[model samples]
Target: MSGPGPARPRLLGCDFSSTPSRRKPIVLAWGRCEGNTVMLEALERFPTLSAWTGRLAQVPAWIGGFDFPFGLPREFVIAQGWPLDWAGCMATYTALGRAELRERFVAFCAARPVGGKFAHRAADRPAGSSPSMKWVNPPVAWMMHAGVPGLLAAGAWLPGQGGVVGAPRVALEAYPGLVARDLLGARSYKSDERAKQTPQRQAARVELLHRLGAGEGRLGLRLQAPDALGQVFVDDASGDALDAALCLMLAAWGEARAESEGPGFGLPARMDPLEGWIVGA
Candidate 1:
């Protein structure tokens, strides 16, 4: 077909861990998009954030969907007297130790009402992601602390936040739960604990994979994985592989938006730069 169509850009979906170890490393799903199809090529694991950052810096070009909040709530920033802009805010936030960050967050929550303890960014509601300030439960606040600084260090361009001019790798804040909810619909599909990995969750994961391959959501991109890889996704009770695959699809969608809509990576034009919007939210 005319010497084959133009090659698709490499895509990455990260299922990040705030504290990665050999047993629960950050998982990266590598793939490429062809037209409306996103194909998974491989999954890579990094036991440390440094190793992951190094890998990101070496990739020649990619649009990665990273499963972590890229920015904190503007309210939180202002209240803490941190810098208002994305770059300064991230720099100031990352400079503090995890314990110091937790202490500040806990104090902030203690001052507020029980139900409204956490401040939220604009993207949280639409994306159905947890408040970026939460330190416990899912500990996404720690994830942001651990992840975004590395993205900056690696020189990846964050679309709405701050972009590095001429940067080859593009990083978007992605939440696989958004896509997973669309396919699974409040159904539980994964668990980190062995005791929680029930047959019901396993069946839910199978159904989610089936629906994703059939292109069942608003993104309208089908997923294609080798049989063995597909098996890996289904068999992993931790759901890290499946989450990474979902991120890949989101990254592909962001890439398509970049091509058609030009910069901002399909994020709202008026979105607060200090609180970056989740791509495809």
Candidate 2:
């Protein structure tokens, strides 16, 4: 409709599978929001960790709102003596393989029995979720570990990189659901049930489109389907289909927030990823 308005830079949301094994590899979904409606698109199906990284080399240069953490838990870093900063820690993660990484994280959690299992971000106290090495939901921390390097290698910039105000460059470190929970109130719109994919789920999905600010004349935009690109939106009959749709809700919510809020959707200098935040709070 609007042919890519200035207010809305491309928003990308991904639901990564922590254990990207062949039996259940990582799932990557990308999407964008136009006003109240979100255009859902599926990126790739990585059956292996190596193939996943290998394919990430193809992500286009757009302001991405990835569902991965770009930072590490301050507590975990100090306790494990892992590199404390992004650049250094990435190098460390890159050096270690899956077996060693898991073993090390297990030991770290083992040391702290009660709450030791969860590491603390620098902003755990007042704000919340200062990007810790999380391994759940999407195991975003590892996603960051595996994903960010590719973005860097791709020569894209971070969220706050390059003093550009509204540049169409890459800005990683976005949690899409960071906004959806607020609008939907934990309403499970997505499920793995074929029967559950009844009118109810379809309706819920439609409703989400509106809350995301999508409409014919809302954001001055249109979702064009490029014939050359296929399978960008996976309609898996399993729970995976719903999961892919959930990623769209995330993208729409994120786009809405970025349109309203400043600097897109980012935590204050005091948020903690472990405790998590209230989405649009």
Candidate 3:
């Protein structure tokens, strides 16, 4: 009698690259969530950050999970004497060149003791994510710099951190590794290096896909991908496509929560707006 209810909004998951190029583009998984199933529609590649930003702006409505830090640790911000508010802090942060940002972060770390060099967001421990300020070994600091500005400029709502009120397009910070580790548990499922793409890793990918399809995680959502698309997810040695797919699942999970939980998108109510919480953390 309800006649299937309203259609779900389009969902997206982004596997971002700080410096996107043709060889290592930003990978996006476009999909929709229906009941407990997250259906994959396509995988898009953006050869440059500008192209990616343009695509984000063009989409009329979407809930996107982006695999990048949207904010830095509050401790790091305070120690560096940066502004305490999200907008001011981000403005100061984005004004600096990558070289300068790295220099400041390095200096801040050098003042601290070994094993406690990097300051972490509260979300980091629960999400098992690297500190947002780390300049290398992933360079997520660069990711925040390159990625968050575009989200802000595109008028995508960032939940707790400031954004256009009631904006149709929503962006949430997401880390696919959290979902992967939940199912795989310390198993490495993907690698960018050719030599590291062993049969073992490939097997891990197969297992992850299977688990996701079966709705085996806390999110309680199954992944439905076309047979050919599923093969593409597994065959890409880099794991970019697969990671994007993981983010898509997280976005769907958040969207499901939004219907009941309001604008927090499943994030904690008391979360510090200065350091954004990862969705589902």
Candidate 4:
């Protein structure tokens, strides 16, 4: 309920999109420790950056993992003549409307050949994401635009990205799938379809929990259909919800680390407000 502690910081892992207008806003699943067990709360859906952030400010956490770029590739920001610093870069990007930003980003990619178009941050090279602000694959550039400024506005640590100094809110970039893959391999855990959230994925999740050392039994985490918001589906699967659920898992991990490791757990290496990082346990 308070700061990140051995009591388990509240975590929210997010799988963001370049645009959330048509999609299920921003999928959010929150996690915290219930006594000695790590469990998830009911999924909360937010319609915009404002709503998402308002919830975060109210919910005290050591840090939460957001699946978005921490910074834009220095090359891209430089090429575009945008601000060089994290805070400044966010200002420049967020000033533009979605249409304007998209057109400009697309133009940047159009000028370059197939593989030559987008810029890649140093972290993207290791993370295996394209540098360009393309909409598909990993639309990190767009994610940066939508996700970063919100955190900055909330006065969160952003880590590699300089945050509003002395803000109590702290957030680390995180990708739950990365950690899930480590624990569950390529096994698909959640589905967008009412039918696909089957025994198989449930079993997979149960097994995944065990791998995370939660062997006693089911805790607070359980995958269920979102009651209010329209569900998001990919290839006939409810991946959006699952992805949001995964974000919650990542938050739990970040909470654990920040409590044990201090502020270092929330800071980043390169400090990109545009290109985000993924925190691991």
Instruction: Give per-model CA RMSD.
Output: 2.1, 6.8, 1.9, 6.0
Q: In terms of TM-score, which candidate is stronger, 1 or 4?
A: 1
Could you tell which candidate, 3 or 4, scores higher by TM-score? 3
How well is each residue in 21-83 modelled by candidate 1, as lDDT tens digits?
999999999998888999899999999999999999888788999999999999999999999
lDDT of each residue in 1-281, candidate 4, tens digit only: 67765443466667666556544577776656543444555566677778877877776554566777676667767778997876787788878887887787788778778967777665555444345365556666678777777787676876655786545666766666665666676798776468777767777765655454443322233333233321332222445655665566556555555566766663454445555555652
Model 2 lDDT per residue over 172-270, tens place: 454434343444656545554566756555555445444543433322333332333222222332334334344445445545555567654443435
TM agreement with the true structure for every prediction: 0.96, 0.60, 0.97, 0.71
User: What stretches of model 2 exceed 4 Å from their correct place?
Assistant: 1-11, 18-60, 113-116, 122-138, 160-168, 191-206, 213-281
Ten-residue stretch with the least lDDT total in model 4: 227-236
Top TM-score: which candidate number? 3
List the lowest-lDDT window of 10 residues for candidate 2.
Answer: 225-234
For 1-281, candidate 3 gives per-residue lDDT tens digits of 55786455689999999999999999999999889999999999999999999999998889999999989999999988999999999999999999898889989999999999999999999999999999898889999999999998788999999777678889999999999999999999999899999999999999999999999988899999999999997898789999999999999989989988787889999999999999999
Candidate 3 or 2, higher lDDT: 3
Between candidates 1 and 4, the lDDT winner: 1
lDDT of 4: 0.62
Model 1 misplaced regions, further than 4 Å: 1-8
The order by descending TM-score is 3, 1, 4, 2
Question: Is candidate 1 or 3 superior in TM-score?
Answer: 3
